[model samples]
Target: MTTAVITFSPQGLKVMQRIASHMAVDQYLHQAIAAPPGVTPFERVVALTGEIFSRYEGLVYVAPCGVVVRAIAPLVDSKLRDPAVVCLDVGARHAMSVLSGHEGGANDLAIAVANITGAEPVISTTTEAVKDLIVGIGCRKGKSAADIVTAVTTALAGLELPLERVRLLATADVKAQEAGLLEAAAQLNIPLRVIDSDLIRHSTRPFGHSEFVASHVQLPAVSEPAALLAGRRTSLLLQKTAFNGITVAIARENCPSLA
Candidate 1:
């Protein structure tokens, strides 16, 4: 899903630059401040937000939370239809999920941005205690978003687990910009993480091998290794499995039982 990052100050611009390096977002700055290359200037955030509110899937504010709230208050609609909104302070210490925390994916979007900015992610939407499940996926190029959703849902269903326990979706870096993967993550309201191909290729973690992948993509495997590599002290919960043209695997961070 497409996103826009907007800021009100020079300090915020610096934070925006850091975010741009890692995520794909259209950049915007206040009209009074001179914008760096590729960043657009807006006279008023409220007006601009109103105009583009429906165009983007997410809006990240590198400004005060109050200002962000005021600017978006008028455009605020339903959680299911509203764009994901996240706020980061100029110092970049916190990434807050301001709107659409569930249906529209602000919770996961904030986490993804926080991961990039090295900020703490703030999500208030209550669920069962967080679980560290990572779902790894691989798909044929140009697959539709449904293809990805099906693969992930099917994998999770086998365990009778809900989406809340899942932390993120992991895939090889080559699939970072895959349209299907991106939209599927947005649709599922789960963060999508891209593991570097070099890391996946060099990983010693024992997962099933795919001759088709070795011959075609030149990697030992994609799904299982991606899940294994995405979390800390992770162990495989599910091995690689094929769903039509997509492949899926599941991994969880190894923590002692609370029970």
Candidate 2:
């Protein structure tokens, strides 16, 4: 998704710079800019916001909530069509999802911004408040889509979690182009996230490993690391399980309850 970060003061600009770097490291597409000198930044943000509302999926404004709300007022439409708008204090102490909290991803953006800037994210979305499950999978070179689906479903069933409880499916970067994996993700209606092999190895010690897989892929394991990386947690709810040439793992992260 495309994102834009606009700031008013120098402090906000500094925070925006940090946010940009963080987003880039996480492979997020983003644009960052400060308002021009001598002109009112709020006015510039307002003008640019009108265009960004349609052009970008997310908007980050580092200024007061009032300024952001007023600036985007004219372009405000239904939440379904509006871009996710996140407002941060000038000091970068708080990141607030002011509009389009769920469907537009403002709440998730807030949490990511908070992780980068060490600020508290103020997200009020109800669904976002619930913890999401991440499912990680590894399959044979030419596994069938049906086999992949069966492996994932069996893993979730072991944990007594329904398929709808899963929010994301992750696998090693090598599997990013796997037709079976992609097809299974499409059938399940969840995002298929690909993680770099090195990042996966460094994420956490694999719950299970195979010397054969290590020789071929140069990674200790695939499913366990993919789950930990996507869930941002160290432990797994279910360790690697192999069935019919498909391996699956499950992990959960505790999301902060809405206050």
Best by TM-score: 2
TM-score of every prediction relative to native: 0.59, 0.62
Clashes of each: 0, 0
Mind sharing the TM-score for model 1? 0.59
Q: Which residues of candidate 1, in runs, are more than 4 Å off?
A: 1-18, 21-106, 114-129, 257-259
lDDT of 1 by residue, 150-222 (tens): 8899889998887778887888877778899999998997778767678777788899888888887788888
Candidate 1 lDDT trough over 10 residues, lowest sum: 123-132
lDDT of 2 at 235: 61
Over 1-259, each residue of candidate 2 has an lDDT whose tens digit, in order, gives 6777777667777787788776741111113434443223344666667766797888888888998899899998899989888898978778899999888888767766765675656766666446478888988798978889988998898779988777678888778778999899888866676666767567545578778779878888888888877654336889888888888989886655411
Cα lDDT of candidate 1 equals: 0.86
RMSD for each of the candidates: 5.9, 6.8
